[model samples]
Target: MVAGKPFERWRVAGTRRRGLTVRLIGGIIPIVTLSARQNAGRLRQRQEWQFFATTFRARPGLAGLWWGIVVLRGVLPAGFAVAMGVLIGAIDDGAPLVAPLALTGVIFLGMQVLGPIHMALSRNMGDQTAAWLYDRLTDYCLEPAGLGHLENPGLAADQAAARDFDLGQSAPPLRLSMGFIADGIVSFVSGVACALVLFGYVWWAPPILAGCWLATHWLLRESGIWRDRNTDEVRRAQQDAEYHYRLAVDPAPAKEIRLFGLADWVLNRFVLRRRRLHELQFEATRLRERSVLLSLAVVLTGNLAVFGAIGRDLVGGGLALGAAVTFTQAAIGAVAIAFGGLNWSLDSAAAPVAAVLRLREPMATAGALPAPSGPSCPSGPTGSSGRPGSAGPLTAQTGSGAGELRLRGVTFGYPGTGTTVLRSLDLTVPAGSSVAIVGRNGAGKTTLAKLICRLYDPDEGSIEFDGVDIRRFEVEAWRAHISAVFQDYIRFEWPLRDNVAPTGAPDDMVLAALEAAGAHGLADLDTVLAKGYPGGIDLSGGQWQRVALARTLVAVRGGAGVVLLDEPTAQLDARGELEIFSRVLAETRGRTTVLISHRFSTVRMADLICVVEDGAVVEAGSHDQLMRANGRYRTMFDLQAQRFDEPQEVGGDVLA
Candidate 1:
């Protein structure tokens, strides 16, 4: 927990001392100083009240319901205190106790029943409100405009904070905070009522109780500051832990760790990260325990003061014995109720603050980009533009099948990187033509695919589909015609059918795709693909590649016209690669195909081959044309071909 302001610390010390001089010097000075500092802080920072107010305005009815529950909660506790005081006074007065006792019992029962019911209702309402916020926030984050804003690290950090700490726990604290506010109102009213009754006996008691209530409220405010700081630390530590966990356990690193026998090393790293998180949590727990103990001591001291005051008033005959007892009980009950409200209010505010902060990034990013502009379509022969005869076959033809893809001096770079991955290199693929991109490692083949899919925009130049600049086209509409089978394709943990038909039911298209990819005969479509289950089936690397290929084919047959294959046969043998390529060519007879590979054999089959060297196309032509020229393509082909005949060192691994 962060240290309080010097004046605030002194004020807390004054509370412990209960000296008039200390209160005047420490309490007044510190409060004034803190108030000025708070105002200055507010001026320097972005006011979050606007964000919260907007949230409240959007859900006014829900907010009102939550507030109502809080009021009920507060009323119940105050009612209990009043009933207890009345019952105690009647018993001490030596009057007939049956009527008072019955009334008190009824109030006690009502308080007990209403308190839990109110709490339950508040919890349910809070949960629904939180769910609504989560859905809205997620929708905002996933919006195209939101994606642009996520490019900023600050926005990303805010997003992470909200997800890790805010959404799940937001409701509980907010509900409690509302409840505390309601409780405070009821406690204040009850305190006033008790004061009026006591004033007829002794006027001094009301002021003392009020003074203690004010002191405790100050302590609670200070505690809230500490708790917020601690929460921030805990959130950071949890993020660190999550990062380490991903590094240790993610699928990308699994093969390397197993082959290198580094399981123990990875486990140790995870343990160290978890230990650091635990240390932070332990420190927070210790501070909280200390605060609770200190608060308990203060409460005890206040009780002792109340008892001494009551005894003195009774002996002086300034108050009757029954009245003195009633006053003391009322004073103790009022102090407890007030302090409870203060404690709950401070703790409850943390969750809402965290929730608002968490939602800030998504909200700020929302509506950053325009909606996807194009006609929507179900699986059929129609294109995104909803024009008849526009949905052409996938083949080598000028604007007859798929669509011509033209890149005019396209350039791109990854975020935070100094060097560009793709330079201003122009290339063109005629509609329905098979185009091959041959490049060494880090030569930007995958980056080109991402650009084509509109995952990113080029730093310079433009990509066009059928002469239409991709940026001007609806992003979703443009992507609907494209399908990609990347080198790092995900193997879902679902059944084989789901793996094939990711977006729909497994129909004839799925069957055709699986058969074309040479995996249909191996197992039934209903076979479970995941391992470690009763009837689970795990495929080898080559088989998984076949499944991935099948998935791409299914997408193509469904509606996609342009297919991108990034090292689709990286895990396959020479024969397997040839067979897969042959099937792809046959199945996608007229579809536009962009094949990214390092294999010379695969590149040789393309209608046009673009050999990318150092992020630029250095050589491009048909296989025979390039061979006749005997340049980079011929030399690379010769080198790779030699590996089949005789053992040779393969230089610079292509698929990293």
Candidate 2:
């Protein structure tokens, strides 16, 4: 028995030590995990703050004023509560009503005065932030060295998602961010003050209330995350909805919609897409409802326990009656203020704030390539990983400015499609010559032009300038070597001078270009191109074409090595086409030019005529040589010629 007693004592000592070690490690593990998570959270939060800070620093005075107001807001709420408590105590002691009433009046008046000032500050902040963000977005989109991102499906979808939400809403992310941060600060400060007041009554009360609030906060945060988790789905649905809605109402499609009687069909499609979006939103609402209900239940249970304890203390003389009344009001007021601030500030801001973060993260690393003028271009163009003898530098060609271009085994496909638009197409255009590309629609003629302008690179093979792989040169610098006018050219709605500004050309040079393009009759330097502006007038399609051609001529005048004209005279009258073509022939003499057209008049004049069919050059020769060969070009030319020669009947009269 004596030996067993010592054994029991030894066993107890070892077990206690083991238990102590296990408990210590278990306790420490959570602390360590929590610390790491907190650090990560802080780091992420710091980055978000830094993004806003970068923007806010541009207008430092506004930031300072806004922050001052936010800090004052924090102090005011706690001050008001404290003053109320003191006033209540004074009233209980039969103190003067004047002091309490004066104090309360000042607090109420300040809050009321803050309303307009806060609104003014918020409005100013929103406008400034929107302008800055729009500039940033524009730069980000336009400055990419390549057109790949613009063509990328996933990136486009993400953009549609982020951009679709911002339409017509005054509450931008940055604007809401300001209010959210301010309200959060106010809530924290007020909570602390309230906690301190409650601490005097019972040390344990503050901890219980904090725990309950934290639990509620966690649920709210999770619910928000749940809503954001499916943004891609939401974005896609929105795009579909917009597409259908446009089909129903857009002026461009109005004629087709009415003739086809597609109003109901389009509206139905819009409803379906919007319904899909609403379903996802409905799911989010349910999650929010669940979280809210649970939070309310938790609050009710915790507050009941707390109030009951306080009541017991009051009845037992542990707390004075007046102090009890003050405590009760302060406690309830603190909870209400904190909850109100959080609910109003955080909920509306969540989606927008998250979108900002998501957008910044993706775009930060996107389009890493940039175009800059320099000599950092790869020297060995022949060694650029492609088929041998494909292409090399400009010096490798017969002569400089001889209009030499080589497409060696080039292949490409548009995004989201496996079908190749250009397949292993090899062709060479000699310097000081013109090549006309004739092809059916979808024959990759426009795609070839995009490649030469460095808008898109070939998936396989090489497009060489002179003899060098074009990709080796900086995109913008290389693009400066080419002038192009596309078929569907844009008519910018800016002043004529502004549209053509930054060209570094003198007025005489610009006027010469305008004359060359037959667009000299359009309004002058200060004239706006749209109808809403005073003295503004919209141009016809042909006039717009002339303006677009003038823009191209400016590029050519600035010494572009090559010129690309894609149906440049498509919208012009027969005489107008002849005039523009005459100018093109004269100006582009002694330089390389690639013209894409369906008309026989221009194609027959090319030094070399190539027929692009099924993404390959199927026929090539000079006009006379192709006629002799009696191939694809000859057949197409004969067919077009026959059309003009055929007789036509107009109102029962033959017009031959």
Candidate 3:
């Protein structure tokens, strides 16, 4: 019985110790978790602040001046408070009023003078930041050798956000929001300085008052006043709103909106999208009742405690009137650090900055071309990476000759699409010769052209230049050798001369190229293409096609050895297309030429004709040779020939 009692007593004590240990751990877990969360938040804020600083550093001179002004503005508030107290003390003592009054007046004048200068500086810095960000965006978008990233659906949201951030639909522009950021920084500095001044009266008072005011931030966090609200929902809403707004404002859609009487519909859609975006943003960043009450309670308790102590000291004659007034002013100033506009303003500015930075790596990866499988060749004058912009004028290719082109066992498909656009295709174009390709729609003719241009590499097989794989050469160097007018060519809103020679050429050369394309005398060299500009005139569809051809011709004249015409004359009629092709052939007779067309009349003029079907070449011969063979080419040609006479079994296909 005695042994059992001892054992029972020991077991009971061990159980009690275990309970104590568990209780200690339970109590400590919340503290540790809260500390970790707070630390993480602080680290995030620090990183965001660093981004702002880096953006400011983009223009060092302007940023330095801006910082100088910020510090001066922050100090002015405390200076004004002290000067007021000193002037009052002078009055009470019957001392000379001139010096104290003059001091106070000087501080007030400094305060007034600094405001406008600060605003001007902020505006300039903000503009510089915008330019810096734009430069980075351009580099990321253009640095890639291929067009893959530009077409990726996954990056569309970030791209839109980065592109249109300054439009003020999703967030305030950096130009206006930067001033708010400055004000926030000044407020925090003023608060800390004022707390220091309060230390002169009572050491304990500053910590208690500062702690209470700072605590309000934590207590009122649920108010969502200062948090970043750039959730996925917000970004999606922003993109939708931006799309609707662009549809209403852009010139391309203006005609349809008015012609179809969709003006009201577009306007209503834009309004609804904007309203939805605003609603989502607000929902993410609206104040809550409980957080507001907690914040108010904390603030009230801190102010009352600090002020009541000051009152007691004054009434008991423990402190001088001047000191008491200064302390009171300091106490009021300390509240500047409490939850305010700075948090939200920072949020707005930081969101875009963070987004732009985050996109840099992924965008670069997306845009980058797959590494070449063959041995690398020495880059042409276009540099090692083969960036197209670095290429020299046509005069730079003085010694280069037209090279033979060949494709063997080539296969390709676009990203995210399950179907292949080109199968194991093979063809050869002898140097300085012309070959024309004819195909039904979706027969991979345009895709073949793009592959040859190296705008995309083949998925399998090889496109060779003079028996060497095209991938072995730098992309820009290979591209510099070829010029193309695509079916869907760009109509640059630049001047007529620029439209002919985007990278620039001699005036005589540009004029000759324009004349060849039947685009000469359409407009003046300096006339802008878009009607919105002064002295600008819009061209008809056929005129634009000629201009696009002129662009390719100019490249050919400069030194390009290969010419690709993919339905370049589609905007013109059959007669016009025949005339254009004759002129084009006359200009590019000696150079290698690849023409993709449906017009049998024009197709017959080529040195050799090839027909593509189901992503592979099914026939190859001359116009008469293919007709003699009575193959796919003959059938398509006969169908088109019979089109003007009688209705055929086939409806309108590419043959038509």
Candidate 4:
């Protein structure tokens, strides 16, 4: 019996020491500071609060309401604990139970009743903030004047990341940060209250408990990253897997994919490849979960020791009944607050926040060109109004405003690839003439056309209309007078009237343009071509080509000074292509028309034919002149003609 007494005393001493340890080291354990730099170098300098500040500034009233709710939610536990402690303490002191019971009942009921209302308010606030982030980021992306960032690979990836949040493929950054804010404040405030209660029993207990909480939060956050990781294999596997997946789903490959019967094979490949890509991330997440659970285990153990010390005093006639209830709940609250929302918000915000921050630098500097004059191209801005903006380009006629187009030392290259596509090549398109430019693919025909349209500036040259540099005039003002039909063009899903009359041309004018382009029976001006409309009618590819042709003709008939057709019939069948070219050429006789085509039949009718080779005009003349010259144009034309005339043969045997 004597030995048992000493052993019991030793056990009591050990428990006291453990309790004392928690109080002394409160928050002495370090917090894991999450730096944006860890994700991408550029994100390190970004302000994560951009979303908050923008929303707050835009809607201060809403912001105030949100802030009030979060703060109240944060300190709810602390408020409840203080009120409960008062009620219990009064009872222990032998005061009347009625007032104390009434107060406690009110406090308990308010918490339960207010929970749902508080949650709804919180959700509304999050929705407001998230919506602001979406709109602000979206405006920044689309407002750029240039198309460079839109097509760049690095910026494109950032765009994709940002769009994921817009499309809800990922968590909103504001929502994540809110969880970090609201839940983290709850945990901290409640924890501080608990530690303060522990302070009365032991001077060291509060600090020790705070320290354990900090350590638990930090350790759980970095458990997956507490050790070194190999990432190369993961990234490579992911890229390979994504490539296979894209090939299977992308519309560009749909025809070939079915022809090759690759549906099942590629689908199976995608499944296997996705597994490979996820291998490392899955393992890391699992490891982190294990580490968090393990940390929770240690924290609960320390908590049990503290609770035991307090419970012993309450039971053994050394502690007041009110103090016992407060201390017991405080210990549980401390642990509960420690595990609440800090890690989740921090982790989830990483991707979207990184995208938001990194995108600012690239997108801000893009599209910095001079603002467009207006939405619609103003009529006769160049000389029609006796001013530079009036009839110079848009209202210019062949002899009156439009003159010879001259290129001087023109040079250009695609973005990211510095290899020059156009060199120091000079050419002229005389006014009141029909000119045809023919070349092999990538011989700079398309680039030349784009330069004329001023989609991109020439690296080191000037293109002049009417002896004045095209750049001196506003870009859209100059382009407004030039009607261009490109090889690849959109067949818009709208009414035929809307498609042909984007400038809101009159019904009579629209009918005239349609008739000129040989699109008589396809659709009238009022006919809707969209599938979803009340009376929409679908048009075939050939019919659509005719519609696009009519649209171009409307621009020309509207007094466009110059007409450009770049392989306009490339998508049509051979006979349809030939027929359309013949009609358009006949329709554009007196206007300054520039046609780009490979088919010699189309080129044969041009007033002047120019052969482009290696970014220079190698030959120029009428058909008879070019045939006598026997240069690149003549050779190409003969080769095409010969193919049609010759009989098919295999190994010196003609096919029967």
Per-residue lDDT of candidate 1, residues 563-652 (tens digit): 889999899988889889989988776888999998888778889999887777888899999999999888888888876766544586
lDDT of 3 by residue, 547-597 (tens): 999988887776677789999999899999999999999999778899999
For 1-656, candidate 2 gives per-residue lDDT tens digits of 98899999999999999999999999999999999999988866653454446446547788778767766765565556666767877888888878877887797677667756876786677557556656656666676666665666767655654554445331335565555555565566566566657776788777777667666767776443335323677667766776787687667699888899988888888898877766765455444778888888887787887889989988998876667875675566557333534443343434443454456545544544443335866443233221212234432433333457899999998755667899999989887789999989999999999888878777899988777777777565466567788998876778876455334456776677788888886778678988878898888889888878887777666555578999998999767888898898778787789999988787787889999999999999888998899988889998988768988789999877
**Winner by lDDT between candidate 2 and candidate 1:** 2
TM-score of each: 0.73, 0.79, 0.83, 0.78
Q: How many residue pairs clash in each candidate?
A: 7, 7, 1, 29
Task: Return the lDDT, model 2, position 100.
Answer: 79
Candidate 3's TM-score? 0.83
lDDT of 1: 0.67
- When 2 and 4 are scored with lDDT, the better candidate is 2
Q: Which ten residues in a row have the lowest lDDT in candidate 1?
A: 386-395
What tens-digit string does per-residue lDDT give for candidate 4 at 601-620?
A: 87787888888888877888
Tell me the whole-model lDDT of each prediction, alpha carbons only.
Answer: 0.67, 0.70, 0.81, 0.68
Best by TM-score: 3
Task: Please list the residue runs of candidate 3 whose C-alpha ends up more than 4 Å from where it truly belongs after superposition.
Answer: 1-47, 222-232, 339-341, 370-400, 415-419, 438-443, 598-601, 608-615, 618-643, 647-656
Candidate 1 Cα misplacement greater than 4 A, ranges: 1-69, 114-126, 145-154, 164-207, 213-223, 226-237, 246-264, 275-307, 334-400, 415-419, 492-495, 503-506, 531-538, 627-643, 648-656
TM-score of 2: 0.79
TM-score: the better of candidates 2 and 3: 3
